[model samples]
Target: MAPAATAILRETFGFDDFRAGQAEIIEAVSRGENVLAIMPTGGGKSLCYQIPALMGEGLAVVISPLIALMRDQVCALREAGVEAGALTSANSPEETDAVLDAIGAGRLKLLYMAPERLASAAALSLLRRADVRLIAVDEAHCVSEWGHDFRPDYLRIGDLRRALDVPLAAFTATADEQTREEIVARLFQGHAPRIFLRGFDRPNIHLAFAVKNSPRRQILAFAEARRERAGIVYCATRAKTEALARALQEAGHAACHYHGGMEPDARRLVEERFAREDGLIVVATVAFGMGIDKPDIRWVAHADLSKSIESYYQEIGRAGRDGAPAETLTLFGPEDIRLRRAQIDEGLAPPERRAMDHGRLNALLGLAEAQECRRITLLGFFGESAAPCGNCDLCDAPPQLFDATTAVRKALSAALRTGERFGAGHLIDVLTGNATERLRGLGHDALPTFGVGREFSRSEWQGLFRQMMGHDLLRPDPSRHGALRMTEAARPILKGEAAITLRRDTIASIERRPVVRALVRDEDQPLFSALRAKRRALAEAASVPAYVIFPDRTLIEMAENRPADMDAMARISGVGAKKLERYGAAFLEVIAGEVAPLHPARRRLAGGEAGPIYDRLMEAQAELARGPGGTGKPLSCSHAQLARVARLGAADADMLERLLGERRAERFGAAFLEILRAGD
Candidate 1:
């Protein structure tokens, strides 16, 4: 609708035409209409304001909460050759003055700042002088008191917009109808806007969940199947972040730790390293990495339970930002649920906030124990109508649901027969026909319901109980470590007052490769391998990992584009200025002409730690192990020392100390003195 917007969209944003909902949103704001845009993440939310700002008659002041995201968006605009700048906490006085001067001169198109900075004299003076075209608020949901990440400053944003006397647009990835209404009341001061509620559907990511049974093993197996894949593993605390990171590395993953606990500088370094990788896994706490800009991350996993469903969805949306297939795995159990509940119950949140938090937590629990398509369940929460997405775990491999009425009656009878005094383990034994000493000692084998539940195995019964607990149909007695305690919902199932049906658990007869969500058939291998070879060759000369040369999304992009020339190759995503200059010629040659076959001496993963004793070294360990020459890493440390040091990150040194973990101490010992003295 706007010529300047059309030109910018075509050359810079790479769109041939406007998406279904964009042109209208752009036109409204350009015509001075206040607007609310509820686009999904990776949707064109930025454009709704950005296009209008560029084409409108005056400057648009964009208020944002995250300094990191502000910097990234500004950088992208600058890269597109637009006149945009950010007023941030990181800017020095001189930098701030320069930015203010540019805005006053009408030389800046978009100016981004934190809401708290509205009080600053420099920011205020600039906004007063510059003709404000549109006031754009990112994360508008933060103005809602019930929303997570609520900030007091966000409550004042409406006043700021009114004082500036500009038509405005507020955007958020989440907000139920109630939350959206509250956002309008609080953010725009009851002056509602033209609303755009795009459907919430991240169809690229496949959702899955597992109960916490050997969670560590489950995480390792998940990462193993996604070997050479970029992913995130979220931990509940900083210590857990580091522990899981070390565990993944020791198991031969390129894993690293990140959290708010780390020094800012250290966290920045880890973030920079991960941004360039195809498969670098970052194990982190929730407080860190709010808006990572990397687009190639293939999956997101939770080693612990998420606090709420909104949080869970936001986190999982990080995967498949490029619209490639990705995976999400969340493993949780009763202990996690209890711990989360205790935190909520003990927190200082207001009564209404507490009620909203409980509702969100219930939504997350429902997702984990759901029997239908995970995507459908997710969209339904956001009030969007979504048909079953056939790609998720439940849709692909449909579970067999069985009538659990008979099983429920038997379990209730057995519990009552045993005086409801025993925990789940004891109750399970009574139902599974396990004539254990405890059962016989209590003479509970004589109960009418005993042996009646033999129709289902122990696993099926446990799944039923877990889902039942999730649904609030049953309770777990906290004092007895979650012993089954029936509530009113259970009475109906047991007494035929209600009929209940539940899906049978998929009997995992084969040991599943936990992380292998999508497997590439052999027919797609040649092109994939050839594309990888090109990526590797480029990475080698640059001294970066293969993924650093081009993320998996870039390789997939290349396979999809197959551009026949250098210009087209340069236009591919992730082929920025640095890559264009460094690896352009060699890569173009591969795409244009490749006649070579595999040769005997040619090997990838030459530096892979698993291939040799030297390959076992993490990059830091490699630096520490260097002897300036050809001294093999194995000869540098005594075999006993290497074995002793493998146990470094474990809590108890006495356990697995026989393997690796104590290298520094054991190396300095007499057994390794000969090697150290020789400097080998």
Candidate 2:
């Protein structure tokens, strides 16, 4: 590892050791190699670029997808005493001005922006003026048209990279083989990055799935078991999220709903609350939870099936982020499958993309009905192999498996005999010998396949049909009002040349699981609460999220260890030297029941090599304010102007005049240039 990276890792970020793939990634980024790192959620993707930003020359421009994430990370970086700012639509004019001024002054090391901003000519001008040396793309999968969260604005990033001619490092938590290729084609434009596939396993998360039986009741029961722990319940529709959130509230839980349809301010409020509050449940659509950095979320539940296996993994991966045991419960049903299928079919995506989408959904359904470890199935989808994990629902209570070959054959025969003009409901009705008037009118009751499946109950047959869909043996044809269509895979089974097995979906009473603590031990609970209270007060005073002040994991460590002094506190995991110097005293007092108090002018210069230079420039500007003869009109430059002068390498009277204007430069320009030269 590079010494500067190691120093920043320990003193700036407060980590003695790097995570699995971070050291290698940091080394490559430091070497200015184009890198594409596919790490799991909570795998420290931000640090890969952040450490490089601190060590590299010129500004590091980070293109992100969400404004809330940019704001949060900017706050956290500032708290760590790093010179970072964001140019986003959410900023007030004054905030934007400050960011521009900082950029002009060479005072910001990291600049964050939403990808959409890059489309503006003014934004491009600002980047060129900022002299960005590195481009880091977060949520890099967004660049892929084949991915679930494709952003058209992201497609412009390659052009920007070429114009800037800087090495690019792209990072994301979700990208399969196809999505990865699309990303490379779109972002790198043929030149591939040094790829790092840090496996997709989140071992701390315990995965579980259930067939939806009164899904509302199931979700409520699950929430009740983990009451007072932060969790997310994702729904398929905005209306469903609103209804479910209300239901959760009625059941006496602190719950709220989020979706893209909500006002931006409302969405921002929910994002803020999610970052600041603990034990609050957020019922939301897939629109929520991207770029969320909060690490104490205890669980995630899906009230509806996700659109794809990648979506499922990304959603559930939001939990147990602190490497603590977090759990997931996904409730899927026939309706969810049908709805997902219809959504894909109705989208404007090309036929091939639609087909790929269906394949992805089938993979998810296969996981839903997995007979072995959910982890194995999930990881295997990302081209990994693993033994059966003891943490999934199937491992906890193995399902009753049966030889389903005969039932599948009978179902396929019924579909074929019925001319495949009906959906599973009607086909199932015909198979169970339901001699409705319509069936008799069509003379379908006389078919040999009719009544052949009378042995299985209607619900059992429904489950079997769902499993068949999961197996890709049957498809719902949108052109025919979702009629049952047999795939080639079903022919062998229908012909008795193939056999299939399925897990019988049984509706059982909800088993109450023991409530688990969020993170700290029982004895440390009170201290943790106190520490959180302290953090909340600090964050509120600073007008930032609680995690921006110090994430829950750091506070949890504080509560558990109770470091009594600054030196001891600095040894804590997240107590980087800057944070320790800025906040270590105040937090130490809370731990011991006990405390830079830097001027704003000097504070912003903390991490860069320009702090002392800024101080000297300030002194020079003051000394020459009234001119060398001490007879001119009193004059002074702003802190920004002083910072710009301090950061300059070679300067002249004309340049200083342009920067400071005629009179002020005439008075202070000579001294300023001399000081800058001396520092050089």
Candidate 3:
């Protein structure tokens, strides 16, 4: 008999307890139910599916987006002795042979592949023979065309699910309400799954933001404090990554740069070094973090502001995955905001999407110039509320606030007087009493709003303009070369119908501190290092990443508890049964412890007379989808409708017609009723 869920969780995963909301989701999934779990990035999402795979009888196919992610996960599962393998374009002939042999022998319990593989007929045929029982989609938000990480190949998942007729569980960390609805429409065919929207709070990560003042120096200083720690520095452009990597290296640190423009071999080498070596820094663009599985990232620094709040949360989430404290510093300026606006306005998206993109950016800016706790502003974006988190910069050092209503009004008037065709630079020139040649050329020196406010310096005016953009009072028009234009939301402030306030920019007064604290106590430091050394040796011998053997958190637990025997070692959080059998002796010497069927839709009504009736009704519906002769305009009944018909205890032509519509009933009412009555 198959093991119970709790037994599998204890023996295979070594966790004595489940995190908040995990037990309920696992229970639903174990019952062969479709699930959509939206948990935080480091919230142990992989375990929800992994445990089910271990408890079930058939192979659970995982649809992943990247080969790197698949490789890391498969290796980790094998370390726990779960018998996992992956098929990707990067697989060698010998490796593919081994995975195929394992599948044929029924020795593999989990199979990981990319979404693009679902389009291949050979892959579908192989899955049919493999007796697949469940489909788990990682990064399921990629199925939505409206999402930032949308993948065209992900749209094929729904078709694959229908072909296999299996229950599917989709998991993602960053889907909002619109994205969630899109996922349901595309993936589950509008059939809502048992969804679990866990809290979005990752309280272990500290949040902070600073306006750009020598951003290079700012990033450098931030890095120097956390020296010899694994971190990522995200840049806005390719050139910036290279320049910053060089600057970091010149400061006598091990730093490298990565971006999409690099050669595939070069990128692979960087990925290897990052996984194998500790204390290595990689300065990269947004393309670097999606597939990274490292859990000990000490920090993440944004050299330039992120595109939106979703992107920001996702990027920063790479740090502190071990449930340890990590820090984030994001630097922004007026130019950064302008660049983001121009990028959004100049895109080829529809007007509605452009407007939504602008709104998303405004949300990020609001967090940047926030006058209260950063965590509150960040979490509020995802429709959650919480008390003040005393870990952010605002909580650490609250900002000074001032009523900038008059200042915002003056900036709006300058844009209006100049025909709203100038960028922030020119507007700043006109507002700060600077009669530059461009302003003189435009003949704007005698306007009513010109030279009316010279109290603030040029820098102060620039800061105020940034705050105005944050409040969404103004937007940059791409058609006019990024000219600042007032939005409708600004009309109230300009007409004195509303008021505004902003945090006084104190860039020069901010101090630097050590954000990266020691992960373990000093007494346990030596043992932790020893455990890591052993892990590195094992990973190198197996030609896999060090994290594949054991994550840093597991090692920390081992060092702290100092398990002396196999049973005690099996009690640690990450020490599964397989791991205890394979490496328990060595770790003890080091004083370690620790550790779908049916139309998928109609099949949900299984285990009763409705199952066969649903199938017959489906056949009838198919026959009538194009009318009696199959030459009229196409019509069909939804899966939900067919299920409803199958469940009816007694049905006549009129009742079937009511459920199946007049045209469908006229075409196949007799056959549909015959099948329904037989089941009754």
TM-score of 3: 0.83
Best by lDDT: 2
Off by over 4 Å in 1: 92-98, 349-356, 412-423, 429-460, 477-484, 506-555, 566-590, 593-680
1-680: candidate 2 lDDT, tens digit per residue:
98999889987787778988999999999899999999999899999999999998789999999998898899889888899999999999999999989999998999999999989999998888787989999999998776668899999999999999999999999887888898898889989899998988887788888888889998999999888778999999999999999999999999999999999999999998887776899999999988887777889999999999989988998887766678999988778887899999999999998988988998999898898888889888889999988878877777778899999988898898889898888888888999999999999999998888989888888888988987889888889888888999899888888899887644233443424435778899888888888887887788887767777678878888888655467677887877766777688777786532345545545444566788788888777777887887888898888777766777889999989999888788778888778877
Tens digits of lDDT, candidate 3, 361-446 = 99999999899999999999999998999989898877888888898899999999999999888888888778888788888887
Ten-residue stretch with the least lDDT total in model 3: 592-601
The lDDT per prediction is: 0.70, 0.85, 0.84
Cα RMSDs, all models = 21.2, 10.8, 18.9
Model 1: lowest-lDDT 10 consecutive positions: 598-607
Clashes within 3 Å, all models in order = 16, 1, 7
Better of 1 and 3 by TM-score: 3
- TM-score per prediction, in order, is 0.75, 0.83, 0.83
lDDT of 3 at 105: 95
Residue lDDT tens for model 1, 1-680? 87877756754554446766889889898888989998777566787888888786778889887766676677666555567889887778997787778877888899998989877776676687888778999888878775667777887778778778888799987778878998889777888888998877887788887777788888988888888888999988889889889999999999999987798778767876776455799999876555565566788889999998888987887887766678888887766676666566567888777667767887888887778888878888887778888877778676667777777677777777887777556777888878998798888787776777787778767766666667656555556555666666577777788877765663222222333554344554566668777776655555454544555666676666666654566567656544544455566666667423211111111111211322243322444453335364542444444433322322233333344445543432332332323323
Candidates in descending TM-score order? 2, 3, 1
